[model samples]
Target chain A: MSLADLTIAEAGKQLRSGQATSVDLLEAVIERASFTEAQLHCYLTIDHEGARKAAESADRELAAGTDRGPLHGIPLALKDNFCTRGMTTTCSSQILAGYVPPYDATVVSRLRSGGAVIVGKTNLDEFAMGSSTENSAFGPTRNPWDPERVPGGSSGGSAAAVAVGSALGGFGSDTGGSIRQPASLCGVVGFKPTYGLVSRYGLVAFASSLDQIGPLARNVGDALTLFEAVAGHDPLDSTSYPGPVPEMRSDLEAGPKGIRVGVVTELSGEGYEPAVSTAMAEMLNRLAADGAELVEVSLPTFELALSCYYLIAPAEASANLARFDGVRYGLRVDGETVEEMMARTRAEGFGPEVIRRILLGTYSLSAGYYDAFYGQANRLRTKLIREIAEVHERVDVLVSPTSPTVAFELGAKTQDPLAMYLSDVCTIPADLAGTPAISVPVGLDHQGLPIGLQVMAPALGEAVMFRMARAVEERAGFTARPAMAGLPT
Target chain B: MPIEIDIAHVARLARLALTPDELDRYRSQLAVILDHAARVQAVDTTGLAPTAHPLGLSNVFRPDEVRPPLDVDEVLSQAPSARDGYFEVPPALEGA
Candidate 1:
């Protein structure tokens, strides 16, 4: 098999045994990325020389027996939002087109310390505000499954890179299903840890309360590995929880024996595409056959998740994004006065969806509307969390379809913003409640698009979530490679 | 709509200059969003307090100990316009 096709685990094994070198793997990945770049548009920037040097050093260290754990010498991609010292971290927006970070995000530092070779920075929705990568300032990332379909976003580029074997695995941040939704659409594994479990020190904030950094990989094990490498408390992030990071890998082999899986009644049926519902039903049956006790659980307020998320996230985004006023960094537009300069800079810099969200956020948080919009949304958020907590009391994990539908054609939902927002219906509640959730490819729809089965667990319940994901992944036996796998280099 | 002017007001608050076309588009879009978000009102939160954060964390202060800060050059290097060690911007006043 080609070195580019190996999972992080497989690549790490080869590198450790001296059967292959990091340089060889890095070259293969870079070459594959180059060949796919024209069609897939996965990366915002690929650091060829830096990656090569890092891989060479990794090989030298391995030769000297200075191993850096499972990630040592493994090639990967980072979603462009993370601050990588001296590397352009655009978040796929024109405002920061030429901006490079001065410091590495805590996750980037951790990944580097683990000796992972970051080959490139992947694309995303501009400031991670949109559902499809079509909103990206650069361009949309095409799904490897079909060139015409979108690889979901704002982490579309990261998920597409992993799906197409451009990278062994990649890192993407999830605010409202950015990682999981794209991973689902791209037919890969994506994990979104509980909000405070991962540090947000350098992740360009979309929604501070909802944003989290997670992993996307070809398999559950590889996703878990990437998650372990980056998940932990960072003193730099004040919101980071002080709890000890759980040993998730150790529990991978544990089956769903006697595990109670709560199948959320509200998440299934109606609104979901017929094929998606069928795939979900089959996956749930497989879980039941594997000794998992399936019980119908209800979170009545689930319908309010999307509305609550749209309000809270945009409000937080408006506040967080106010820093890019053209005074300190990024694009600047000349005006007669400072206020005019700020206005023109923002008008010229931000995209329409970003502007829409900022306007919505500002309106929601404005004086008279605060009690009606922002305050009401927060209260609904509390109710949703409470309802989810009550459900968890009876179940170990909640199961649902990762997305209401599989990957859609490009421009399918872009014209209608609310329709685009609905794509995240099943995935948003977990973010609202600060729970760990994962999307695993279960099967393909009738149209040959991949379907993702979502597994969610309460805060710090990654172990249970992983166990359930592994069970479903094993039973689904989904091994269909993207059609792009056959593309000639 | 009752809050059509709020779109322009919000844009100003956000320091974004929207064209007339954008203003019209956002005015309608924000109205729809607000209409949809109005569903939260049906929940009747009553005495329930709002949740600013799901994890319930508060007052996450770090030590006051001093640590190395970013280099001035590196920090200023990202600015579109910079002079000496400071970021350059338009004048604060029209003719100061």
Candidate 2:
């Protein structure tokens, strides 16, 4: 069995039938994680001993006839941003390097409850601020398909882990396309649910309103399974929704026969590489062939999304991260006095990109500039929300390129921060609108790298996104493992 | 539509004591960044209220309830130095 072909759902089936023991399955996953870690630099830490103990317990549970449903005995990875009690949830930053949380993030608790064994915590950009994992203190995570290129980030490590079969599925947090961009570059399916669908209680705050925890997996089915496990209201996070959670897997069975799929006109051309454009167009053709109506919808304000995002996200981050001052927790820097200590601590703890964000955010939210910058950005955000709402009335799902192109070589655009930020252009609109979007592997480019097709559903419509994404995955049907393919031993 | 990106000012704000070479490099980069940012000014947003959230969920209030914190000593053990019940650090002010 090419374990790569087995989604988490299929893996669960095998585990339930006594076809594979959790320890045996986890050993395979751990080995893959280690192998990929060495080449792709995907992990900041690997917890084999803990994972083995968890796996052993899972076996005990199965022996006791107490299965935790589809996720029982499944191996999963978590982005470093999600706090896993007793594990260093560093967010790949020196600021929180030695910090280990005393309690699990709501998502971590949910995943554990569902019987998923966490193999390790993956690397990411510091504080989930940058589009490239290059900002990570540990080091950049390489794209699994080509070691020379980046895995789209800040969820790069999570995406790379899933892409290389290091884990059956994993969790990632998205702020301005962090999850979807990496998923696209790594050629896996990544979903970012509606903002409030998944509790953000333990997710290390980035842009508070923008950050959301979601799933990255081999296929849409696995994505749905993982999503269902981690999503729902949490008493700890008031932003979490108490509304209806869709039966995503069943919705997939109902399929895309009459769904209205819109091709977002603004996301189509200018910055997109030919391969990305071709991949998206091909998916549109496939959806049309499956009897789904495809229409061209306009998001006129989308051109301003990146601008508004930069201002608003940073403005909020500046406030949220203020609690990290030396007094509270995490890293502390000593100085002659408390004021100096605070200054020294912040100066020494944060990376250049993080400091840049805090300053920019502080400036934007400053009293005199508030109306000119933050206030104006919020207004533009409202218009964006209204436009997206109107468009959804005409379409069941929206289609776009997840990224402008395949992963670029390391250091290629790092020096040009502006160019680097543009990599997220295609994926940012959905984040601004608080919609659910997923990136599914569509095809490969000439050099044999994977491309992704982004499918977006309106607020709380993750099921529709999954149905459409699965349709594209089914039709395009491209399955090439990362260059360093991890076939079972 | 030209905005001067002063590297010295930026360096001071970031608390980085930049060398001459570092200042020049950052100056060139910031110039390009601001030029790109100027695109926002050209946008006609006369009547639009700036958006703070795309999802429209506002007034997200959690129940005010006290929860157990991590072991204080264990959490504080992570600090570089500590004394008594407070974190021990260099004093707040220094006569420079």
DockQ of each: 0.81, 0.44
Candidate 1: list runs displaced more than 4 Å.
Answer: B1-5
By lDDT, the best candidate is 1
- Runs of candidate 2 with Cα error greater than 4 angstroms are A2-5, A485-489, B4-31, B44-48, B64-66, B93-96
lDDT of each: 0.90, 0.81
Sorted into a CAPRI-style docking class, model 1 comes out as high
TM-score of each: 0.98, 0.94
- Count: clashes, candidate 2: 16
- The window of 10 residues in a row where model 2 chain A has the poorest summed lDDT is A480-489
- Candidate 1 local lDDT, residue A426: 89
What's the C-alpha lDDT at position B21 in model 2? 73
For all candidates listed, what's the TM-score of chain B alone?
0.88, 0.79
Pairs of residues at least 3 apart in sequence or in different chains that clash in candidate 1: none
- Alpha-carbon RMSD of each model: 1.2, 2.4
* Each prediction's number of clashing residue pairs: 0, 16
Query: Per-residue CA lDDT of candidate 2, range A90-161, in tens?
Result: 888877887888789999998888888998899899999877798998889988888889998999999998
